[model samples]
Target: MISSVLPTYNRAPLAFVKGAGSWLETADGTRYLDLGAGIAVNALGHAAPVLVEALTEQAHKVWHVSNLYQIPEQQKLADALVEKTFADTVFFTNSGTEACELAVKMARKYWYEKGAPERVEIITFRGAFHGRSSAAIAAAGSEKMVKGFGPVLPGFVHVDWLDLEAVKAAVSEKTCAIMLEPVQGEGGIRPAPDAFLTALKQISDETGTLLIFDEVQCGMGRTGRLFAHEWSGVTPDIMMVAKGIGGGFPLGAVLATEAAAAGMTAGTHGSTYGGNPLGCAVGAKVMEIVAEPEFLAAVNAKGGFLRQRLEGLVAAHPEIFEEVRGVGLMLGLKCRLAPGELVAAGYAERLLTVAAADNVLRILPALTITEEEMAEAVSRLDAAATALETHLA
Candidate 1:
């Protein structure tokens, strides 16, 4: 039999019928612990009552309207984002790729409007995963992402990650912006050190280059902070956010300071369903929950517990895992075996995990996962490691 849908993803041979709070049920009634959490989209966990209520209520009233009109839901979400982060303005998009597109455009337009039309080049780092759009692929500059695509986009300048000297050399007057991920997600959960971030900020300030942070995967509550850059106390001129902001709904946003967004006037950029009412409603509720001080504190505590347990696992099975790295709930285990092999083993153990580059396994549990769920997740991982060892032996 042929499949109807486009085979874009190498999907697992499993179909989940329902999910609730750290667990997913397959069509055949088999339950699995859901540590992936829809690739970190379900920050409040699956089928959270607060998110469900918000979505249901908004769906009953209004689902979408044109951007020409004043959508109260959109305004409320924008207001919440502005209040929480360093941004003074917000532009909603349907996904992180769109937000990345806007961020690039906004940076170029800022320089253009300031009478420096030649300053259109955006300096991006290697191993950074911005998104999948044309601009994003170019910004990422990865051969795996840009190989089959036609001629790559022209305005992006790629450099090695953490190479401060290279970044300094790259930032000529033609450079419009310096874009990077505070914590590189698809690049194998590598975090830019706090000192390195501060250095980048200082260099950007000295050179008047706009700094953009693609926080799509590490933002929200994934890092036990509102945004990962907050941990370094180094803010970007513009930031991209998504994945968890809608609590499993599809929504993304580009946030900018006032001066950074000065070039975005009427008719500059717009989306038909960017800030749709339903998405904004759910996003507002997500903000309310994640922005709570107690909730953030709990995430930090849970992250500590999970990291400690994972360290123990690595020590117990040195042949399986090399080390554990990453911050907060967004953790990664560097494996001695191929990450895909461990992923298959995890499926057999009825535990879901995500794979990343450099033979790393990503453990992105929901922010609201309970202590018991964390323990179970570790135990399942232990079993998977044991199984792999036995098979290899």
Candidate 2:
């Protein structure tokens, strides 16, 4: 039967009707342990009571109010973000893609306001996924993403990942910003070396170019920190955040220092549904929970446990897994077998995982996942690997 939805994604065969904590259920009551966590969006797990209460209370009071009027909820969320991070100002958006768009615009406008409009080229690294929008796609400049899109947008310079020499050669008076993900999620759970990130910050400072960090997948407690860059002790001039920041709702934000955001005057940018009262109310509650010292410490401890278990898995199944990499809950199993095959096997074993480039299987569990659930997930993964080995034999 034909479906009304666009076939943009090669979706799985299963459809879940409900979820709670780290588990999901089908209509017939089959349960699956969800390590994917909707690709790291459900940081607090499914149907979190606090998030539900926040949304319900906000829904009863107000759903949305235009930007023309003062929205207290919006102001509160922005204040929380500013107080916790390096940014002094924030612009809300409906998704990470929209935040990326505005970040690019803000970078270029900064240069334009300085009477150097030619300083519009943004330097990006290879194997990066910004978004599908025209500006974001052009900034990424990946052949696979930009192939079908007509004439690529200009003013973006693409370089190999971690090639410091290449980045040095790419930057010039025309370079508006140096943008890259601190942890490349879609590119196989790669974390930029801390030294390299620090070097980039130095270069940006010396050249007077803005630095942008896309923390869409690795931020908001996914990496055991409020933001991934916090581990490096380096900050960006502009940062894009989403995913877990909303708990489960659709919300994103572009954060910038007052100096970097100077070009954004009144009427320069706007989103009708970006900072609605409902989303902000829920987002504020998410911030309150994820920013606590005790909660973050728990995340770090769980990450260590998960990493140790994964190391054991790699050692036991050398024929199936080559290595285990990544930080915190955003771990990846670099598979000797095809990642898609492992993902399908996991489905058969009633465990959910996501695949990434470089033949890696992502294990992005919710921050609140219990120790018992983690053990069960590992047991299922072990079964899946054993099944694959036997089938191949």
Candidate 3:
């Protein structure tokens, strides 16, 4: 049968019919432990009681309204976000890509408002996945996403990761911002070094450029923190957040310091479904839950456990895994074979994982996952690795 949707993603064969906290049930009676959590978007896990209550309560009240009127829930969620992080203001969008678009725009606009309109160039890193949007694609300079699209948007410059001198040289009078993922999720789960993040902050300040963090995939407790930048002891002038913000609902936000957001006045930008009440209501609840000190600490402890187990697997099967790297639950295995083939093998073993750039297999689990579930995931990973080891041997 013909479908209206474009053929883009290489979808998995399984169609999940129901989910309950770290487990997915297929149309058949088969159930699979879900370590993927929809690629780290389901922070609180599937069918969470608190999230269900929030959604059910808000659904009866209101759903969609034009942005012409003030959205109280949006304000509430924004307030919670500001109270928890370095941001002073937030602009909501419907997805991570839209959040990225806003971050890029706000960075350039801030510089323009400061009387330097020529400073519009945005420096991004190689292997970064900002989004599929035109400007975001240009900012990412990803050949795979940009191909077949018409002329690329101008002013985005690319540099190699960890190349401080190249990053320094790339800056010019026209440079308005330096955008990078705190952890490169699609680029193979590579975490940026604390020193590199610190240097970017310093260089941005010295060059009078805005430092932008695309925390869309790595933020919102995925890194065992509210935001990954907090671990680096550095913050960006502008930050893009999404994925786990709504705890499975689609929501995204671009946060900025007051000075940085000054240019995003009423007429500068807008989105139709950006901050609908339902999404904001759910996000507000998610923030409230994730912000608890005990909850974050639990995530940290579980992340350590998961990583240690994965490291042991890597050590035991050196021929199958080169290394296991990443912080918190957003971990990866540098593999000896093709990442896609490995992901397939894991799936066949009733385990789910994602492939990324640099031939790494991603293991991004829900932050709220239990230690027992993590142990099971480790066991399944061990089985997958042993299978690969046998194949290679």
Query: Could you tell me which 10 consecutive residues in candidate 1 have the lowest summed lDDT?
Result: 1-10
Query: lDDT tens digits, residues 125-208, model 2?
Result: 988988889988898888888998979999899999999999999999899999999999988999998999999999999999
Candidate 3, residue 269: how far the Cα is off, in Å: 0.7
Candidate 1 per-residue C-alpha lDDT over 269-332 given as tens digits, one digit per residue, 9 for 90 to 100: 9999999999999999999989998999999999999999999999999999999999999999
Tell me the lDDT of model 2 at 22: 95
User: Model 2: runs farther than 4 Å from truth?
Assistant: none
Per-model TM values vs. the true structure: 0.99, 0.99, 0.98
lDDT of 1 at 170: 86
**What C-alpha root-mean-square deviation, in Å, does candidate 1 show against the real structure?**
0.9
lDDT tens readout by residue for model 3, 1-393: 656877677788888888989888888868888878888899999998999999999999999996889999999999999999999999999999999888888988888889999999999999999988999899889788788896999999999987899999999999999999999999999899999999999998898889999998899888888899999999899999999999999999999999989999988999999999999999999999998888889889999999998889889888888998888888999998898877877787787788889999988888888889889888888888888778877
Candidate 3 weakest ten by summed lDDT: 1-10
lDDT values for all models: 0.94, 0.94, 0.90
Q: Of models 2 and 3, which has the larger lDDT?
A: 2
**Lowest-lDDT window of 10 residues in candidate 2?**
1-10
